[model samples]
Target: RVVGAAKDLPPEGKNYSKRYDSGEDVDRVLELNAGTVERDNINIGDNVVVENL
Candidate 1:
């Protein structure tokens, strides 16, 4: 649910990496998706590829 919300947000820029905004924005994103992210074994500094559906 929360993760879906984050995905729905537009990407920060035109970069291929699909970066999100930083600082508080980044913190908020992580906060929202923390549960599912943790379940998937993803961690800070881990390399991840997010695809748009």
Candidate 2:
């Protein structure tokens, strides 16, 4: 799971949902675009972490 303040994720036709009453630390679930990931050459198990936006 991610830490720190949340930022606005890219709006590439993505979707989000909150299936449970998660605490402040854990809120919504983000769904990214598969095509975008593929195009970015991000493998199935790649470490696509970012910091400071």
Candidate 3:
């Protein structure tokens, strides 16, 4: 989950935008917040390509 702009994330999820504003390391923050199983699907530091519809 990605939290920010009215989006929802898990309890441990830090506000993505807030993190950005604070210049926190995003991938590391995400990894830290994710559960063990979630980490399997989403590897921090991996390249992610987004497609706009």
Candidate 4:
């Protein structure tokens, strides 16, 4: 997988979903590349909890 460069993630806020016609997908979360994650010492299958500050 391609490693994503260190970039600012989209801010967390209300997200509008056209498919569901709702904001259900508004967690405002994005996934980093596998390599990027691994570089941060997070291995695959590891349980992780991320909270917005």
Candidate 5:
């Protein structure tokens, strides 16, 4: 699990209409492209960390 702050998010609007006011929770999962896994023996359960900028 992870906790952080954002300058924009959904439920406020499809676009960032309430970005200037405050942000909200945005929890979701992302799928990695098949080509990104360049390992021969990649496991099914692997831990990955991604940073958004």
Candidate 6:
């Protein structure tokens, strides 16, 4: 289940997404390498939640 979707994320950094639906700036938001996730993949347009590491 998707928690939420944001056009922008916190912590400025590069973020990668399979889809480019989201116009989030690449300079901001930690980006995950393409294909880094498998089984269940999360794309740019997909909503997600960040938990405490």
Task: Write down the TM-score of every candidate.
Answer: 0.32, 0.30, 0.27, 0.30, 0.28, 0.30
lDDT of 5 by residue, 2-37 (tens): 232232233545565542311435455443444454
Query: Per the 3 Å backbone cut-off, how many clashing residue pairs does candidate 1 have?
Result: 0
What range of 10 consecutive residues in model 3 has the weakest lDDT sum?
1-10
How much lDDT does each candidate structure score? 0.47, 0.44, 0.38, 0.46, 0.41, 0.47
Q: What TM-score does candidate 2 reach?
A: 0.30
Off by over 4 Å in 3: 1-40
**Cα lDDT for residue 52, candidate 4:** 86
lDDT of 3 by residue, 1-53 (tens): 33312124445466554433323333433233336435455443445444672
Q: Candidate 2 — which residues are off by over 4 angstroms?
A: 1-30, 51-53
Cα lDDT of candidate 1 equals: 0.47
Give the number of colliding residue pairs in candidate 3.
0
> Predicted candidate 5: what Cα RMSD to the true structure?
11.0
Give the higher-TM-score candidate: 2 or 6. 6
Residue pairs with colliding backbones in model 4 are: none
- The lowest-lDDT stretch of 10 consecutive residues in candidate 4 is 18-27
Give candidate 6's error at residue 44 in angstroms: 2.7
Candidate 4 deviant stretches above 4 angstroms: 1-30, 33-35
Query: In candidate 2, residue 26 scores what lDDT?
Result: 45
Per-residue lDDT of model 4, residues 1-53, tens digit only: 12223344454468844232223334334466546664777553455566883
Give the per-residue lDDT of model 1 (tens digit) for 1-53.
13223434544475676554543334334333436665686555566565672
Q: Which stretches of candidate 5 lie over 4 Å from their true place?
A: 1-28, 39-42
